[model samples]
Target chain A: MNDKLVTVLADVFGLRREQIVPQLTKDDVGNWDSLKQMDLVVSLEREFGVELEIADIITMTSVEKINRILKAKGVDLEA
Target chain B: MKLDGAVSLITGGSKGLGLAIAHRLRAEGARVIVADIDNVALEALPDVFDRRSLDVTQPDEAKSTVEAIAAMYGRIDVLVNNAGVIYSEPLVNLMNPDGMMHSYDRFRQCLRVNLDSVFIMTSAVVEQMVLRRTKGVVINISSISARGNEGQTAYSAAKAAVNAMTVTWSKELGRLGIRCNAVAPGFVDTPSTRAALNETIIKHIEGLTPLRRLGRAEEIAQAVVAAIANDFLNGTILDVNGGVTI
Candidate 1:
C-alpha cells in the first residue's frame, strides 16, 4: 500500500518515502497547508487516474484516509 | 484547449464588449452561455446563446449559477469574468462645494462590481472545474486603466487587482491544468467608452496611441481567443490596446 502513495506524498511534501506512514497526518507535515492540499490533490488524481469529489478531497487529511478514499474509488493501492 | 464544442460562460454578455466576445467565441464553434445583470437585454438575445440574469458580485448567486451551468452542460471549459462598470471620478474635487474627496460608498460599489465579481465568479467556476477534473480556462477582462488612469481611482485599483489575481491563479492552478489570463483593452470604440469619455477625450486618446485609433471590441475578443488557443500561454496579461503604452 505504501509503494506509490508514499512516493507521491514524499514528492509533494519534499519528504522521504521512509518518512511517510499511514498514521502520518497534515498536522505532522510542516508544508501541508491549503496550497499544499491542492498540490496533493493534483498529484493524487494524476497518479491514481481517479476524479475525487470536493468532499473526498476535504476529508483526506491523513495518509490512511487518503488510502481509504482511493480504495473506495477502486484504486488498488497495494498494487 | 480548442474552442470547438467548448462550454464557455461569459459575464456581462448581453451587450457591448461582452456581447462581441460572445459572438466571436460562437464563431469559433463554442457553446456560449451569456450571463448579465440586464434581464431585458438577456431576454432580447438570440436563441443561439444560453442567457441568464446574474449579478456577479453576489457570491451565492455566482456559485449557484456556475453549479447549474455545470450540471446542465456536464462540464464548463471556460469562464470569462467580464461583468464590470466603467467609472470615472477624481480623488479630490475642490471645485465641488458639497464634497472635496471621492465618496467612499461609490468607491466600494466600484470594487464590488469589478473586483469582487471576478473573485466570486472565478471561485465558483474553478471549484466546479477542479471537482469535475476538467482542465478549464479563465479569461478576465481588464483595462489599460489598470496601469493608472487619471480620474479613475477605483476602476484602476480594481483592474490592477484583477491582473494580479490572473497571474497568481495561473501559477497556482497550472498544476491542475487550468490556465488564467487577462485581456487588457485600451479605449475601445464601444458605447460605454463614448459614454465614459467625451468626444474630445476620445480624440486625444486616439492621438496618444501608436496605432492612432481606439481599439475595437472584436479585436479584444480575438485576443481572448488567442489566449485560449495557446495551451502554454498561461499567466499572460495580453495587452490588446494597439500600442497605447508605447
Candidate 2:
C-alpha cells in the first residue's frame, strides 16, 4: 500500500519513482508547492477514485498519511 | 504569447465592458462564453460569446453554469468577473435630493450583483481548476472607486473586497501557476457613460484625469490580455485610470 502511494506521489509531482520515499514530507520535495499540492490532491483523488472535501485536503501530508486517510474515508485501497 | 484556442468565461458579458472584452479576446483566438441575464442583449453578443445566461450571484446558478461549460468546452482557461451593478447616490442622503429620486435599494442591489456574485463564480470555478491542476487566469474587474468613492459606498466596499481577494487567492493558487489579478478602470467613457452623466460632469471628469479623457472599454481589455500573457504579473491589481488614481 505504501509503495503504491509513493508511486502515485512521484507521478503527481513529476518526479522519478526513485526520488520519493514513504517518509517523503512536502518540505523535502521541490515541486510540492501550493499549486503542486492542489495537483497532488487531484492526482490522489483520481488514483483512489475518491472525492476529497476541504478538510481532507489539510490532512494529506505524506504518502503514508494519504493512504491511511483514504482508507479511513472508505477507499478500497486493496483492490 | 497567445490565448488562442483557450476556453474563456466572462460573467455579465453581453453589454458594456464585458462584451467589449469578449470581442477583444475572441479576436485574439480564445473560445469564449458570455454569461448574462438579459436574453436580448445576449443575442447581439459577439460571435465569440458562446452564450451562457446565469445570474452569477446565486450558488446553484454558478455551479450549474460552470459545470455545464466545463462539460461543453473541456476546460476553463480564463475567468473574467465583469458582471456588476452600482448606485449613483450618496449613502446617507437616501430621502431623495428634492423628491422624484430613486430609493436607497442601491446598496442591496449593488452588494448582491457586484460582490456576492464574484464569490459564487470564483468558488465554483476554483474547484474545477484545482481538480484539473490547470494553470488558469482569474481577472476580477474592480473599479478605481475601490480605493474610495463618496457616492458609491457599496460599490467601493465591494471592489475593495475584490482587491483583497486578488491578494489572498494569488497566495492560495500561486503554486499551481494559477494567476489572479484585477483591473480597476476610472471614468471609462462607454455608451452608458454618455447616458448616465451630464456634459458638465463628464467634462469635469476629463479635466481632472491626467489623460484628459475618459477611458475606453478596449483599453481595459488590453490590460486583461497583458495580465494573462505575462507569467510574472500574478496577484497584481493593475490600475488603468490614466494616472487619475495616483
Candidate 3:
C-alpha cells in the first residue's frame, strides 16, 4: 500500500521517489495548481481503482490525506 | 447540455455553424441561447429560442452576456464558442498598401472576435461552472486554418492558440467534470464564405481534399455534438475537414 501510494503521487506530480512522502502537500511542491489538482485525481483513479468525488478530491489535498481517504473509500491501495 | 433538458449558450449562433448546432441541440431538447454581433441575424433566430446581441470580443460584454444567460435560465450545461471571421491575406503581402497590402484592421478584428472572445467567454462561464460544480462542456469552433492555410495566417495562428487553450482548460477543470475540446472545420459554404470566396480557390481545396468537395456546416455541427456527448473524450480535437487536413 505504501509503495502504490508513492507511485500514484509521483506519476501525477512528476516527482522523484524520494520527493514523495505521506506528508507532502501543495506547499511542499511547486507543480501543484488547479489543473494539476485535477490531474492528481485522474491519476489516483487510474492507479488505485478508486473513483473520487469532487468533494473528496478537494479534501484529499496532501499525500497522507489521500491515503487515509482512500482507505476509507475501499481502495485496497496495496495493489 | 445534459443531452436533454439543459441550458446551452452558443456564440455566433444566429446562423451558419452556430445556428446549425443550436438547432441540433434543440432537436435533442436542450434549451438554447444564441448570441451574435448582428441584430439582423438575431431577428431571424429560431422560435422559442433565447437570442441576444453580443460582441463577445469585449471581455465585459462576454462576461455579462454569459452571466445573464445563466441567471435567466438556471445553469449553463454547454458552451459552444462558434464565433469567428477571416480574410485571405498571405503573410508576405499582408502589409501591402494597395491590392497586395492586406488589411491589418480586418486581421486584428478577426483575432479579437475569434480568439480573444473565446478566452473571455470561457473564463467567465467556467468560473461559474466551477462554483456550481456543473461539470459542463466547452466546444471551441476552430478551422483547418490552424493547419496553416497560406492565405489565412492570422486565422491559423489564432486557432492554434484556441487548440492550446482547450487542452489547458481540460487539465485545469477535469476534476469538476468539465471537458474542453475543439472542432476544426474545413471549407464550408456559409454566408461568410459565399461573400468573398472564389470558385477557383475552392477548386484548389477540393483537389487537396480526398472527398473532393467543400464541407457543409451541418457536418461540423455533428462533430461538436459528438464532443459534447462523450464525457471521456476530453482535451482532444475533432476535425471535420473531409480528409483535407490529413
CAPRI rating of model 2 = incorrect
Query: In angstroms, how far off is A2's CA in candidate 3?
Result: 83
Worst 10-residue lDDT window for candidate 3 chain A reads A29-38
Residues B172-208 of candidate 3: C-alpha lDDT, one tens digit per residue: 8888899999998888878888764655456657778
Q: Which stretches of candidate 1 lie over 4 Å from their true place?
A: A1-79
Q: Which is superior by lDDT, 1 or 3? A: 1
Query: Regarding TM-score, does 1 or 3 come out ahead?
Result: 1
Q: Write the per-residue lDDT of candidate 1 for residues B39-75, one digit (tens) a residue.
A: 9999999999999889998999989999999999999
Name the 10 consecutive residues with the lowest summed lDDT in model 2 chain A: A29-38
DockQ (C-alpha based) per candidate is 0.01, 0.01, 0.01
Can you write out model 2's per-residue Cα lDDT over B167-212, one digit (the tens) per residue?
8999999898788999988888776677756565677678789889
Q: Model 3 segments beyond 4 Å from truth? A: A1-79, B94-105
* Candidate 2: regions farther than 4 A off: A1-79, B94-105
Error of 2 at B199 (Å): 2.0
Top candidate by lDDT = 1
Instruction: Please state the Cα-based DockQ of model 1 relative to the true two-chain complex.
Output: 0.01
Query: lDDT of all the models against the reference?
Result: 0.91, 0.80, 0.81
Q: How displaced is residue B13 in candidate 3, in Å?
A: 0.6
TM-score of each: 0.75, 0.71, 0.72
